[model samples]
Target chain A: MADEHVEADNAEAIIARIEHKSRKIESLLKQYRPVEALKTALEGSPPNTRDERCKSANWIMVHRAIMAIKDVDGMFSSLDPEYYDILMKYLYRGLSTGDRPTCDQCLRIHEKLTERAGLGCILRSLSDTVNTV
Target chain B: MAAVEVHRFAQCITCHAWSPDRSMLAFCPNNNEVHIYTLMQSKWEKLHVLQKHDQIISGIDWSARSNKIVTSSHDRNSYVWNLEGSEWVPTLVILRLNRAALCVQWSPKENKFAVGSGAKTVCICYYEQENNWWVSKLIRKRHDSSVTSVAWHPNNILLATASTDGKCRIFSTYIKVVDAKESKTVSSSDAKFGELILQLDLSSSWAFGVRWSPSGNTLAYVGHNSMIYFVDEVGPSPLAQNVAFRDLPLRDVLFLSERLVVGVGFDCNPMVFAADERGIWSFIRFLGERRITSSGPKYGSQLSGAFRTLYGQPKHGLSNDTNDHSRPQGTVHENCINCIVPLGTSGSSKVMRFSTSGLDGKVVVWDLENQADLSEYF
Candidate 1:
């Protein structure tokens, strides 16, 4: 059907967009700019796409960007407060993976982010059921 | 700093209300009876016991003008009490609810009252002189879950409800016979009773408490997720903002003025939030002392503190240690707070004093007149 064709086209376009963003985040990480990589990964995150494939692909890029950062406090200092809620969502997503290193890193960032932002960040991330990572 | 006066009345208090003159207190002591107490020569003396509810009383409110007391209970009923010459007489209300009545409040005019129930409906009750009893009109088929709290607007025609469905809704309760058409200040004068005005879906979790500002221009409510939401311009295009806090979720909220709000719940402390000149609401500070952290003492002192706790001398010897964590020390209320009521004249816009009751069965009055830090808020 024509509807099926449109759906397929949309999914393909989202996948291509994810790949392009991942490459840009990777190049930023390569240049030893983890903060920029993080900002890039978090931009337009929890993307408007409902496709599981697109979401997983975007998460992989975000996880890579988060893990690349060496100085957590230094990176958080320069980060904007507007990204706090989005970053918190991704950190929760990272913890859900059950991967040991990913959870450890996410917890470290979560602790610092909570200290910086206060309790509202956690409540927003958990209660905002519409915007899942 | 605010002056605090603590009164321990029971082992647990479900809800409380103050008499019109502020000389007596009526509170449900986590049971079926309502206890009235008065301060006599610096001691709280039990004045009367009104035992009528078959189950635990859930809500209580004393009308400042009419000097009547209304109470709802888990027994699926409500009653209006009249003080007749030293004896309190109870008149049963026709709520007709199949489930428990969770909360109740009198409208500003004291001619009617609204009750929230587990039946997922709000019963707006008014006195019927012909029938010689109270009657209720139900607002049904709107709430998806149990209604948690109900607040009447200052206009006496608009009612706001908080529900477990994570929605705060406004409805016009303008009864034709009871409310004057010109008194519909917030909505159109011709708006019918039980008309839904607005529904806010800002909270994703159960919303607990809802309150209206003194001028009835703003609405504030708290969620189970430790977030407090403020809604302004309450019409078709109302603006709402949610401010999340780090402490435990609040069970109830009270507006001290147009811009100042105090919330109390699982934190066992009343946290104050105020709006700035731009009307952006933010956490100001804890009206109670800040919570003490456990990282204060070294390891050796911690061991000594533990020993003191084990030897039953924790209060005297290890008063500074965090070992006795079961009960929060230094705070007046030792358990989750359940309700807060203003302590000044009922219709005042700026309240200088308020009282809070908690699950620990303590009622503490906070006087804010001399609080230097809070002067700016007024």
Candidate 2:
């Protein structure tokens, strides 16, 4: 029973962290810093929490941050190579939404990302089952 | 330019190994039988067929010291072949596996071998003089999925395994009977058999090939996600680096020297990765020749031709999508390359030649000593 209490506390901590991260990302977007917002969204992406609500909420925040960007090339130019794999995962998640505009924007970003990061980005995003976005 | 020699052995090859002298070859023709071929009069001639496995042979390893060939198969069995007179005889290894054995490799000392299996266990088998047969000890319950490859450390006591569990693990296979009580190299000499030394979760996808450097200080493995990881300082606080590449995932990897590594797989090419003086590993270049784009008819013409064919205006009744075959063109191997074995003199620290076999039924020998482009990387 005590172990269950500890597990519940852990889950609540994860949910609170997700909300904090999402709000930070939104504030970055409002400050006209899409690149910084993308960096923040991809930092610890597909958050470690297994909670479905937290996952979808994080996804929505990531998607908004991704769609807000006007300069895809400029945003990618400053993006570090370390974030390429996580960004690719979020782009694939966007494509799977079946939302037309989201897919179009994702495709544009995917093409540019692939050109910059190469085929490993696509393979890593698709084959990684442990960290599903 | 590197000298590349290609030979078609069969319709498809699953795995291959070379004799101690590198004179003869043993390969599975994508089937249950293992075929031996010899270079007779400057040509590869069939020598013998070892038909023992009930299912497809998945792995083969030739021990240079003992001159024995060990093969594992999907039939849930393994065989150690020894030559008596001109005929080869097989000794069965009792690998207590409920699922298929995926890969096998003899230890560097040739005293024992390890087999990875679909049963999510690794069997470290050694010869028991009292039993007069090979017996295995299971390393159980650690792996969550099938083990894909097993590589023995140069120290002969440490074993590294790559698995579908998306992790590469280091285990101490120190059997008290076969190994000495005190060792100068490995720090964990007192660890019991099948003790987990370290586990690396660098790859988030299924890990395929795992290999140790000649000095046994570094470990490298490839993931299904087209990334290869190099781990240095195998003790506490190991340093790991992930080098992602721009091609299809590699099935196997080989170390040429302390700093150079060659990887081959579905790309049907061997790519070279090297570490700079700073010890950061990166993709260098492909050993295979670059594919030259054919200046054939444009896609617009092909689309119009397809339209004509749909309208029953067939010209010569040929399908418009003639170029849509699945085989990859303009590479040495038309299909996925499965195994790569170094073709160098045994005990040498540096390798200049290597042989690769693939699903395209071709074995290509590559001599990289004369490659001007690779000299800088070396």
Candidate 3:
């Protein structure tokens, strides 16, 4: 019985560690700067080559970070208000500039931000657009 | 090539092909009763309805792979009936619905199914090992208002949905796997689909049904303008093509083949408008069936051709007739062409036509071969 409890505790510890790491990765991705992380995914990680695999592992680390946000963030609201501030900033940037990037590019930035900033009010606003709320 | 004029025949107000291999036809004369006729032992045999639905059966789908027929009602539940022990048994009842159901369809492979109601969600039911269907995944809060119809992609990996809110959504079934994991915490299942995917704006016009082609290359939708729109993945985005009836409007549209499309509307004078050499929608005058769709009234070519000659109306009725013979040439029954199916390859083979119901609420089978009456039901 004690051993089983210990096993459960270890599992909890692993999950907590993953969550902590996810937080760090979420903060980095929220920057959505596309400088360090995306570069690592494209260049650092070549799944085929040994050298590439090491780099690719780094890229996967970032993906794991993003995928982790997907798992833990579901407990509360899908939209995090803290994330909304970042989204609005991006939306504001796009509207202000005639030079707009592709929506797909915008989506990556938005998703990363959504992961970092869980904004309740802004999520509600966005959700209301489709009468889905 | 072979044309038969329909004479006295029972026009099916509604019909469902029970099994795909040997499709059985069922028609509802009233709200609760179903008249069944099957082709068994190489002959047509009318089967007695073993059961009854207390309310109106708005939509019916027969599993083409199995002897199962699914029927939906306004009472907010869908019943799956299976042929067992020489009798139909209620195998499954999906009662999770809190609203009225509009349509039900079985997946092409027969393993999964979709149900849509006035509710904002659509439940994709997967048959479990216990022989019961479970709400495996829910595409929750899908519509602004109500979802009228849902269709599974032929591959079953994608879902196409239409709603009364005038928006159609295409969702990847992959997201359900994501949401299913979250369902462990029921209180927090805001649903990954809660996020916007692809949204089609139909203005205030309600989108009633959506279907993807068997090849998954094209999508066709039926909307309020009595309209049909086709979209294919090309160029940078999907291009919408307007096919069939520029003005007359349509009740529904079905894709039977790549080039052949079928459409029917609330208008009584049911017309099949096949595209001409230029692929422009052209109305068929029902100058008699080129063949028979089933066994039905033979609307003889003599009357139709005579009617055409006496009126000297154009075969392709495209515009208003200021000519003297153009006056009503005569009014055909508006409700008679309730449901139509093209018999041959393109689904527009013009060989024989099958109809559901309109006037008498009977399953009328037409034999377009002899241009004479074939069979009728009370």
Candidate 4:
């Protein structure tokens, strides 16, 4: 019983942390600070934190941050290349776990990034993943 | 302090316009209808709904003098709304363009209006008193791509049009039939009605926003390449200078004065640019750059936030743990600013305030004096 209580406490703490970070990210998005929001989201726990919920809040932040960038090419130029790696991870995880709308957002980011940077970024990312594996 | 009011309409505001008294506003919520709202008891109340278009309403302009509203839609139609006995009457103008009408603007004189369309031509419409209807004359043979923005010179005779073809052209819109007045202020030997007087190739990317100075001698426009260019009417042909900014593509621009301009776009913050005496334009700084930070939360608010976070309460329409709800943005606008309209009791060139509406469904009014004072230090 005591162990279960401790686990619940730990879970609550984790959730509170996630909520705090997610809130920060959402405000960044609403403020049209997508680059900053992306950085904050990547620093904390996995954005797909609440799987049981209808839609995980972190995924929504990721989706909206992507939407805030009106020009994907401009975003690519503004952000560091490594952020794209984090975005790709979000894309894969979101596609596998997110809802239809979230998945659609992920796909759009993928399409736009690919359209902007073309096949070079994708091919390079694929090769990098293969080498690491 | 500059008066700043925030209206949360909760839908994408495709476009917005203000009435003559500035007490009423008409905006399209990414729909076919335009909703007119009036300020009552310091709150906005819906006064009327002007509905007729079958597609998305793309642009709206309110003529303060004439007290008329002009709206354009993707359905390739334009309507003029005149309020008569509390009823808004809509008159369809013979636009004659086959493609979608993207933007519409009432000329400074209120006697004419210009409509930019996806058909690569701008329709200059004027009232025909004989038939008691509106007729349009096409300004063709210049823009090879869709006309995105059109601005009438302060003189009301010259029209400046920006297009997706990466060209900004100035045309003489002097309709001899409707405009019987002599062109005493702005006229050239070759500046005839519907004549393409000058064209400036600013960028290879799509040109989005264009504006003419109060003096009608200088023109400024923003391009998709994240650049703003200036063109001075140096004799028959103009000399153009451009400066690229490290930001997103500016969606709209408005001249605060002949030397200063404010641009807004996906950045959600208005940026100010200035032109030196040498006619060289350069980036000054961003206005309204301050943002709200969540660093210093009071103990009571944090406790309540914790409970709300634990129970998953919807804050600002954002549900669950997916998005932030209650946290306010630092900037005035929360999304891409689609339009900027100069506001003041005086003339357009001397507007002391300006209003901007964006996709985030927030309308924000900014004071020019405050912004100008702020930009001086930067």
Q: Rate the local accuracy (lDDT) of all candidates.
A: 0.85, 0.84, 0.49, 0.74
TM-score of 1: 0.88
> Which of candidates 1 and 3 is the stronger one according to DockQ?
1
TM-score of each: 0.88, 0.87, 0.53, 0.67
Model 2 lDDT tens row, B1-378: 343778998888999999989999999998999999999899889999998889999999999988899999999999999999998899999899999999999998899899999999999999989988999999999899999999999888899999998999999998878887446646667788888999998987899989998788889999999899999999879999998876668999998888999998866668889999999999887775543213322334433432442343423323434443432233556567779898988768878898999877888999988877667655
- Where model 1 places Cα greater than 4 Å from the true spot, the runs are A1-16, A49-51, B180-187, B291-330
Among these predictions, the greatest lDDT belongs to 1
Report how far off residue B363 is in candidate 3 (Å): 4.2
Residue-by-residue lDDT tens digits, candidate 3, B20-58: 443566655546555566767866677857355676565
Q: What DockQ does every candidate get?
A: 0.28, 0.39, 0.01, 0.02
In candidate 3 chain B, where is summed lDDT lowest over 10 consecutive residues?
A: B1-10
In CAPRI terms, model 3 is classed as incorrect
For model 4 the TM-score comes to 0.67
lDDT of 4 by residue, B24-55 (tens): 99999989999999988988899999989999
Clashing residue pairs in candidate 2 (N, C-alpha, C atoms within 3 angstroms) = none
Best by TM-score: 1
Question: Which candidate leads in DockQ?
Answer: 2
In model 2, which runs have C-alpha deviations exceeding 4 angstroms?
A: A1-37, B181-188, B291-330, B376-378
How well is each residue in A74-128 modelled by candidate 3, as lDDT tens digits? 4224443333432333333333334434333444545444334322223323322
Kindly give the stretch of ten consecutive residues in candidate 1 chain B with the minimal lDDT sum.
B293-302
TM-score of chain B of each: 0.91, 0.89, 0.67, 0.87
Task: Summarize candidate 1's per-residue lDDT along A10-124 as a digit string, tens digits.
Answer: 8798889889998898888889999999999999888775677778988998999999878988998899988988899899999998999999999899878866665546767
Give the Å error, residue B133, model 2.
1.4
lDDT score of residue A30 within candidate 4: 78
